[model samples]
Target: MTLQQRVNELVRACFAGIWIESHEHTDAIAELAGMCRDEQWRLVTWDIERGLRGPSGSPSEHDAGDPLAAVRAISSLADGETPAIVVLQNFHRFMQSAEIVQALAHAIHDGKQRRGFVVVLSPVVQLPVELEKLFVTVEHALPDRQQLLEVAAGIATEDDEMPEDAQLDAVLDAAAGLTRYEAEGAFSLSLVRDGVLAPSTIWELKTQAVQKSGLLSIHRGAETFDSLGGLDALKAFTRRAMMNRRSDGQAVRPRGVMLLSPPGCGKSEFCKCLGNEVGRPVLTLDVGSLMGSLVGQSEERTRQALQTVDAMAPCVLMIDEVEKAFAGSASGGVNDSGVSSRMMGTFLTWLNDHASDVFVVCTANDVQRLPPEFSRAERFDGVFFVDLPGREQKDAIWALYRQRYDIDLSETCPADDQWTGAEIKSCCRLAALLDVPLTQAATNVVPVAVTSAESIDRLRQWADGRCLSADTPGFFRKEVNSGKRRRRVTTKPSVN
Candidate 1:
């Protein structure tokens, strides 16, 4: 059901209190107020500073200008008639207090016969156990593509321009994941930056728009499918899965993908390429950045972040190096004071039940450190193991890096499968810096498969049959018994 219909029905059913969680409070509040106006219900708002505001027969605007008084005023309007809606702003701060709890409980039961309901609006959601059952919570989503397109069209009309509809659609796609206010600001900025109000200008302004949110950032990555050396199977799988164009029949859900591999194995690069391949804008989520200092702030940040992702439906959401973000928190609760547990719970729940069209691509290096519940099949569509690149894959990677930097790979290629794609790229970069051949660069580099042999073997052991291999068996062989090859020791020390 739509937010409007849901709110109307809930109000009709006499839902005592309705709590809304949203980042775009202004938009949500305006929408709900419009709905109330349509239903002809008297709308009132409250703050701690305000006593009681709205149409209570007296029709006095009680402390609307004062934050605290506004909450108090709205809270005091439980006995009013004429079908009233009391919107209490930031009242969650006092939800834990005994007085506020009792007041809200009494107001809920007392307003039953009378057409009155209290609405709590906040950027964060915090409910004491006493009011959890009493209040019905609804999420207020950020502006979606359709809404953003409307905003852009409105802006263009205001500016008196008759741009092509395709250009407008491209602009809307670029502005995805942003709220209404953010989209408007971005559109204005894009118009001014390009000096022509062209669709290309939207990219420049989009960078600025995403920077302000500290949530998911839209990436205009230059990397394409051609940049990737191997993993043809993985690439093909994602290409079909990420298609947003609906087929004749109901399109299958794009089950999320999990990339499991060691660091510097090009997992992150694959994610970015997937977005580019799918022809959709990519949003990168920095999980560590969401951690907050204040109480309940982390959950609030997560909620906002996920809401932003959902608002940009039919897009790819990449969470890089997620194992560190959700590492081993289920047992031994002494670390970080249970913050990890709560974060894990929030993330897992979202991953499991999220019905939005956002396709998640989570990359993790160490499976042992990850929570067991996260690896289950239901959480993600497929879990692919990104083992060390084999000889042929390494050759392709070497050729790719050489071409990228305009270097010759015929005589300078690293012949072995010891290095990962990232390591190979690093070697090529170092070779260019030193004005030397690629083999010389290879001589100075030791891959993780060499330096951390045991850990790499363990990772291989765990992924042997449990995960999909990035390379074929002809090039990269797994030992029959141990599931890993013996590490090669050399006399010369290698570069990082």
Candidate 2:
């Protein structure tokens, strides 16, 4: 529901305390003012800078800048028939004081009888224990596509400055998560730099916004599907799934895919390339980075990070080495005091229920360590197994790396059985850096298939019938060698 509708319902129900979590205070106040005006109710606004002011441009009778007095004065503006709403801007700043807390608690309790309401408007919800039960928290949503279009149009008044259709859609997508003020600034800045409304400047400013949160980092690179070799099946599946739209022309976004593979496979590279292939920005989410030192902080950070990911929709969210990120989720709090478990729960819920256009690509070297619930049907569109590169795949990988590192393609390649794409790249890099032949560089590299032989074998065995093949269609099947051996006969003695 819109902010005005929610607030109107709560006010009509005589909910004494309403907490609005919003970063755009001015926009929120303007909305509240409109709602009050429509309902013919009295509206008063309070802030540290403005003290307390009514619609008539008059100050309240209470002492200036005193939160306790503000709370007590809320009842004076209301009558038995008419309702009054006193908006407390940044009131969370004063929620720490015992006096303010007690006064708020009393005001909320007495407000219902007098048809008076105390609305706390702040960017974050920091209600004290005393008033926690009394206040109902609501989020003021970030502007949607239509609203953002209006914002862009408002700034770009000139005929040539405005974009239309697809170009306009791109601009709105870039401005999706920004608040009203930020969007206005971004639109204005776009006009200043590009002489027209475009996505470049908005994206530049968006990078700064993401950096400030310290939760998500934007992945900017020129890596595309052509840069990587193999994974044709995986690539085709993702492209088709992501491009599928509803009958109404809306995108029917795929949930995501869980990539299970040994080290050196192209899981991480494929994820990055997928973003470029689909024309979406890749957002790298570091789950370890979201863990906070204080209690409840980790969960809050997880929620915020996920929310940010949702805001940056029509994008890819890549979580590398996801197994290590939620290592102790299944330990039942025996390790790390249940922080990992709670965070995992929040993530799992979102994975299953989120309706955003984000395509989550989680790469894990060891799926054995991941919780079973993580790979369930609805959590991801598919669970794909990226085994060691086959002969054809290895040949393509070798050719690509050869060109990339300026290696001589005519030279003989070393024996690369069980080698992955990464190992091949490493061989080429080492050959170029050391000015050695590919065969010589091979001696310095030990493929993960050999280093982690037992683990890789176990993984292949588990995925044999369970996971989809990253290279080919249908379920993955481990190739088994027949036991027949070839025998050599001596011709001279006819020993055979």
Candidate 3:
């Protein structure tokens, strides 16, 4: 339901205080004002600059611009019949004051008996401890597809400026998580720059929008499944599983995968490419940035970040090195005072319950750090093990990076032993940078198989027969080496 509808019912039920978490206050206030006018109710809005604006738009004399006086004046606008609404815009800025808290407490208590309601509107929901129980939090959602198309139509007025029906889906999809204001600006910018409204400008603006929260970072690169060399099984599964387009109203639950691999594997690269492969945006969830210095702030940020992920639906959510991200959760949070534990709980709940069509891709080098419960079924469709590239896979990876680095195919590539896609790319990059052959450059590139040998061995042993293979179609099976003797000497006669 819209914020206005929700607030209308809550106000009729005598909810004295309502906290609206909204980024677009102008639109929200306009909707609220129209609702109040239609219902023939008394409405007044207050802010630090305008103080209180009544039906006449005149500044109230109750200490014009004084927050405390404006809050206290809500009682004066109350009556026995028609309900009165007092909107405090950006009231969270003044919530730090104890006196204002006391005044608001008094006002809310009196508002119930007098048919007056206090609505706090802010970009964030930061309810103070004193008013937490009194206020009901409501989220103002981002513009939907239909609303975005309407905004697009308003901007691209010319006949040829607007995209056609089939192409307009991409434009609306690009503006999915944007505000109406942002959408208008994007549409106008696209029209002015390209002489046509397009999704390019909207996606460019969306990257900036997603980065502002310091939680989710969006990747809209040109990478696709063609960019990666291996992981055919993984690519096929995700391509077939992700519901990029829906058929009916029945909601499809989210299906995620847990990827376990040693460092330098194609896990991260696969995630970045999966979005473009499936016609969706790739959102990287940064867990470290979610931490906050104040109490409960970290958990709140976690909730907000997940909410954002939900809002940007039909997208890929990539959480890289997730085992280390929530390590404290498995350790019982003795490190960060259980903040990681709470964050983990919130994430696990969302992973199981979120109704949005977000394909979660979590990559981890070391899965042992994660809690045992995290591997439970129903949370993810499968746990895939991305092993080091085999001979044929390495050839493909080498060919990919060779073309990327402008290396000639005439010169035979050097021998690569247990090197990952990343190491191959690094080798090619170093060869190109140093003007050396692949053989000499390969000397400088030590594989993760060699560096983290023990850890890799343990991981390989753990994932063997227990996880699905990224290269194959089913559960991964460890291959027995059984090295062949080059040329056996005739020393069998001397066997003692």
CA lDDT, every prediction?
Answer: 0.73, 0.87, 0.87
The segments of candidate 3 whose C-alpha lies over 4 angstroms from its true place after superposition are 243-254, 484-496
TM-score between model 1 and native: 0.83
lDDT comparing candidate 3 with the true structure: 0.87
Tens-place lDDT per residue, model 1, 213-330, is 7866777687887888887757776777766457575687786888887778888888888777877778899888788997677767887778777766668889988878866475
For every model shown, what is its TM-score relative to the native structure? 0.83, 0.92, 0.93
Model 1: residues with Cα > 4 Å off, grouped in runs: 46-80, 92-109, 128-133, 158-166, 191-199, 244-250, 330-338, 408-411, 414-417, 473-496
The TM-score ranking, best first, is 3, 2, 1
- Local accuracy of candidate 2 as per-residue lDDT tens digits, 1-496: 9999999999998899999988898899899999989999989999887788987657866655777778878877778678989999999888878988988888888899988899999877777778879999998988877888888889999999999889988898888778789999999999999999889899899888887888888876889989888888899999899887788888666899999999989998998899889989999888878988867889988988888788779899999999999989866656899999999999999998998889999999888888888899889999998988887889999999999999988989999977889989999999999999999999999989788999998998898788888888777777676576422111111235
How far residue 389's Cα lies from its native spot in candidate 2, in Å, is: 1.0
Q: Quick one: RMSD of model 2?
A: 6.6
